[model samples]
Target: MEPMRGGWAEEAALAHLLAQGYRLLGRNRRTPFGEVDLLLEKDGVYVVVEVKQRRTGRFGTPLEAITPRKVARLLACARHLLGRDDLPVRLEAVLVHGTPEAFRLEHLPLEV
Candidate 1:
């Protein structure tokens, strides 16, 4: 997706997460491994969110975009940001489908 569209999707995802009571810690955070889309904290646990947006389902669902490699990179980046691997970290995905004005989003916990 285009950067502008990606930004819009991220903004939408952030809003959704915020409304769900997840406090924002960071956005587009970069580490040695890669960039983490959103870092959130809720109930004392760190949430590493991967925001995936799809305008259409021609290719696949937004959640289908997440690959094993992507998960690994996200994990590495999250651990790097926290400076430890033992902390409670949860991987999640904010799957958005449709335009910014009319989108459906689902928050799902991702398995490590």
Candidate 2:
């Protein structure tokens, strides 16, 4: 995706999360493992949100874009940032479908 469009998707995802009472802790945080799209906190639980956007399903759905390797890297990055493996960390996904002006966003909790 284009950087500008990706930025728009991230912003939309952030807005959606904020509306649901999730506090933003960080965005585009880089670690040795990988970059985390969004880090948020809600009810004492830390969340690592991976934002994905797709114009169409010709290739695959937005959620399908998250590979297992990507999840591993994100988890490792989150652990490194939090400085502990025992902390309660939740993996989530923000799936954006269609263009920035007309899109459907879905937030789903992921377990892996």
Candidate 3:
């Protein structure tokens, strides 16, 4: 497998989200547990996002890559970033797939 450029996918996801009216809060927010790919706010609600991308479906869709263990880690990281575990914040996954010239982005909200 070729090395994937995560930054490229992340940038695509960020631009897609922004165009959809989400306000950016942070990107690549790190914690001991994991990193939140994108943290956003809209309509006074916070969203913690995970971005997954693939150059092709020869393996699987980007959404298929998100395992339960990853979700747990993402939840923990989001909690750490917010300094609480009970926030009503929502979790979302952004899937970016395809080639650079014809990339496709999909948002799966309420992931957690």
What's each prediction's TM-score?
0.93, 0.94, 0.88
- TM-score of model number 3: 0.88
Two-way TM-score contest, 1 vs 2, winner: 2
Backbone-clash count (model 3) = 0
Whole-model lDDT, candidate 2? 0.94
Query: For model 2, how does the per-residue alpha-carbon lDDT over 11-77 read when each residue is reduced to its tens digit?
Result: 9999999999999999999999989999999999999999999999999999898999889898999
The positional error of residue 78 in candidate 2, measured at the CA in angstroms, is 0.5
What is the per-residue lDDT of model 1 for residues 1-112, given as tens digits with 9 covering 90 to 100? 5466588889988998999999999999999899999999999999999999989999999878899889999999999999998999999999989996898888899888
lDDT over C-alpha atoms for residue 49 of model 2: 99
The C-alpha lDDT values of all candidates are 0.93, 0.94, 0.85
Give the best candidate by TM-score. 2
* Cα error, candidate 3, residue 3 (Å): 11
* Model 1 CA deviation exceeding 4 Å by range: 1-3
For model 3, state the Cα shift of residue 103 in Å.
1.1
- Where does candidate 3 clash, by residue pair? none
